[model samples]
Target: MGYIDLEYAHTCHVKSVSDVYSLGVLKLEVLIEKRAFSQAEEEMNRDLASFALPIIEAGNIEETLDRRPVPEPTPWQLHALKHVAQIARCSVKFAGKDRPTISEIIANPETACE
Candidate 1:
């Protein structure tokens, strides 16, 4: 459910944007070190995107980051993490038009890092 695009589900067709949404879910899973569906998560947040989007949008990405690493992320790494979250957030918008193009996603991190 977390990896599926709602638009594709209803329309019974696949689009490029559907891939973007799935990428967003994948990013969320990586960031949180959690699977797309996790029994460990709360009922409402069993879906990784649902659990993460709010935190990312709220600028509380730190709360959703995987903390198991021996040393926590540095300030610079935190900035990069925020940008990645932003990309994921844009990619997962309910309306496909609200998402960025693949080209835009590719261009973003480069510009954002500069």
Candidate 2:
């Protein structure tokens, strides 16, 4: 839902971690349904970073799930969301070697399912 803006004299390369971070932010936006700027100040708080790590580690991805009741998501939908969380986490691993390659992800699509 968002695009990266990179200014450079030559080709710009984006890291997998940057992509993961962007996906995380997008996921949060969908779940929260509020303007990003509305919570910009709070988002910068160090405490939120600490809180996020535990939730990510505990597999509590559903905590960020959208609560809107327009059309209830099926179990499969929930599973898919969890899968995305896992992928995002893996892509953001501290060590680049720990991350899966784009081709690997494409070949193992089911890994994204809960």
Itemize residue pairs with steric clashes in candidate 1. none
- lDDT, model 1, position 22: 91
How high is the lDDT of residue 12 in model 1?
83
Clashes of 2: 0
lDDT of each: 0.78, 0.50
- Tens-place lDDT per residue, model 2, 1-114, is 122312111236556545544444454455434433333576553322233446666978676666685355688887777776566555444444565666556688556322
Q: Please, what are the lDDT tens digits per residue for candidate 1 over residues 10-48?
A: 788888889888988888887778788766635655777
Please report the TM-score between candidate 2 and the true structure.
Answer: 0.54
Number of clashes found in candidate 1: 0
Let me know the TM-score candidate 1 reaches against the reference structure: 0.84
User: lDDT: which candidate is best?
Assistant: 1
- For model 2, what is the C-alpha lDDT against the true structure? 0.50
